[model samples]
Target chain A: MKILIVGGGMGGTILANNLARRLASELRSGKARITLLSASERHMYQPGLLYLAVGRMTPDELYRDQASLLEHDIEFHVDPVEEFRLDNNEVRTKSGKVHGYDILAIATGSRPAPEEIPGLAENAEQFYTEESAIKMFRRLQAFQGGRIVIAMGVPHKCPMAPLEIIFMLHDYFKDRGMLDKVKLHYTYPIGRVHTLENVAKWAAPEMDRLGITYETLFNLKEVDGAKKVVRSEEGGETPYDLLITIPAHRGMEVIEKNGLGQRGWIPTHRHKLTMEGRNNVYVLGDTTNLPISKAGSTAHFEAETLGENIAAIVKLGAPVRDYDGKVFCFIEAGKDRATYASFDYQNPPQPKAPTRAVHWFKVAYNKLYWASARGLL
Target chain B: MARRTVDARGSFCPGPLMELIAAMKMVAVGDELEVLSTDKGSASEIPEWLRKARHEHLGTEEKDGVWHVLVRKAR
Candidate 1:
């Protein structure tokens, strides 16, 4: 069996590591092979960027060498796939090499497309990338503090990020003793404060307690940088001294170019985690249009199930289980306090009040993410 | 047979639970397993999983902040 995993993000890394471990004997006997092709040599703890934007974490702490995180038996390469030939069960890389696979898992994650909205990218501070995160931090530092507006668009990759960043901003400003001078405003594209009803219920009060004002049903239509204002699709406008945003996200261009999915999100079978029509082709994480949060833990849990099933395919010629739509996310409420939501298709998460213990756990997990990529945690 | 103990003390939610589930697959029916976790979430989640998976719940105890959830493979 030949397994080709594209993209070394959370889902791909965990799946590759999990499969390598489960098929150790098969790999040793030359009965199975695992090859991972990634666009970069480093794996990033993406959630750390939320902290990075707020100066809680440094850049160096968010990365690990991708090769070092993989098992020794796995064949790893930095050649990114340029073309996907699903018809041939192969992919062509940027280096003009074609790799064939008996099984293929696509984990090409989403990217923040602030460029989708006019003036939004140029005016708003976003923290999706290393450069942008640092830039956001610098912008936050120089702010004289009037109103810091957090505007959001539909389908942001990490849906919880805008909320988390807003909370962290409260702490960051409080730590700087600028709480009285700064007014925090948040706007979401949903009917509620959050898409998750329970999370909205929990967070609305938290926002109120912290004196953070919010507007629901507000979408990022455009930003008029000259006026220092953002206009919503609902025909409302909010002025800001500083604008921080979680822009709408789109999956990789390669996926779109390959016609694998619309706007790069492949239609996937929710329980099977397979491409809607293609059995041998699998989709995970933000690459899948599953109507779930594109959180790293969603990818992690999906990888766990995909790994087990793929390993079973090698050992038993059939998969044994289903994905069950499980997702878990830790919501950082504010300074030294956190809560989490764990839910599936059938269950909606009712996040309890924030606690210091859960906050510490999130702090610990930031360092432990490397172990998780290696499928140890 | 003595009940097997899976020490997951340092791991958090889903980590300890995933470890326990992975270990359960290797054990035989009627085999007992104990999951030791410090995660408050997993301590509660494990018993719920046992109930849903139709496994026999032995007991759960918390000592010094670590939760010990015991179960027996029913099928």
Candidate 2:
């Protein structure tokens, strides 16, 4: 079996490792081949960026070379995916190299692009990506303090990220004794901090306590960089010296270009992650609209099921595993504490509990989870 | 050596680790702390972490699908 996986981030890496280890016997017998494709040589730990932006996590902790994450048996191609030729069961890279597979797994994660926002593209910065977020983090440290606007472009990845940023910024400025000069403004389209209402109820008190100015249900229509003003869909305008934004995210263009994507994402079977319209094709992680948080933990869960289902599909010719869409994310609130929340597709988010222990868990789990995926643990 | 039970059941990830740290602080050396966790990741991860931290991993037993892991504070 030739298994070609596109996108070598959380989902792709996990799938590659799981299959490589589970089918090691088959692989040793020359019965299986796996290929991982991605555009970058670097694999970033994105959740760390929330900490990285506030100097809680070092830049080195947030990125790793892609080859380090995959198993030795899986062939990795560090190049951009240009198109997916479904007819031939092949994916063509930007270099025009075409490789055929019996089964294709698309895990090409989404991109955080703010170019569509008026002045946001020109002046606003994002903490969603490594390069841009690091620049903004550095810029924030040098700032003596000004009107800091942490806003979100619609459909931003990880809806709670901007909220976490503001909370940590409060702690950062408070530590520097410059809290008086810094005014934190948070604006998002959702009526609350997160898409889930129950979470917002619990989080509202923290924003109030921290004195962070937040306006919910406000759409970001435009940003006037020169004037330092941000206009919302409701015609509300706010000014800022710096804009840290979570931009509008879109699926990989190659998938859409190949007619594999619907709107900004590829459609996949809710449980199996199989491509909706294509057989022997699977998609996972943020590349699909799975009604789950586009998070690493969720990807881990999906990878577990997807790997099993794919193996069963090839052997028994049946999809056996179903994704529960479960995800657990630790939200860092500075002050050496974090909150834990678990969300499943079938149920409401469970109540969250904040503790210093969760904070340490977040710190340790980051390393442990990374190590586990690479089998370092 | 004495044994103290940390009721970490229903606690989320990393919470167990933190509770262990705090419990270790309060107890004397050579004391054993047993953590009962419902999170599958924590149940598996705690023993490996104890080994790496040079703490003694007494054992991990499963009951009704819940995990009970015991560790002796070596430090």
Error of 1 at A117 (Å): 0.4
Question: Against the hidden reference, what TM-scores do the models get?
Answer: 0.83, 0.80
Q: Which residue runs does candidate 2 get wrong by more than 4 Å?
A: A375-377, B1-75
Best by lDDT: 1
Misplaced by over 4 Å in model 1 are B1-75
Compared with the true structure, what per-residue lDDT tens digits does model 1 show for residues A214-304? Answer: 9875767799999999997557799999999987777899998999876787888878999988999999988986656777998999999
- lDDT, candidate 2, A261-343, per-residue tens: 65356767767777877878888888875555667776777888887877776667787867876777777776577786786
Cα error of candidate 1 at position A193, Å: 1.1
Please write out the lDDT profile of model 1 over residues B1-75, one tens digit for every residue. Answer: 547766655432224554465456457889999987766666566676566556788888889988888889887
Model 1 RMSD to the real structure?
14.1
lDDT over C-alpha atoms for residue A47 of model 2:
83
lDDT, candidate 2, equals 0.74
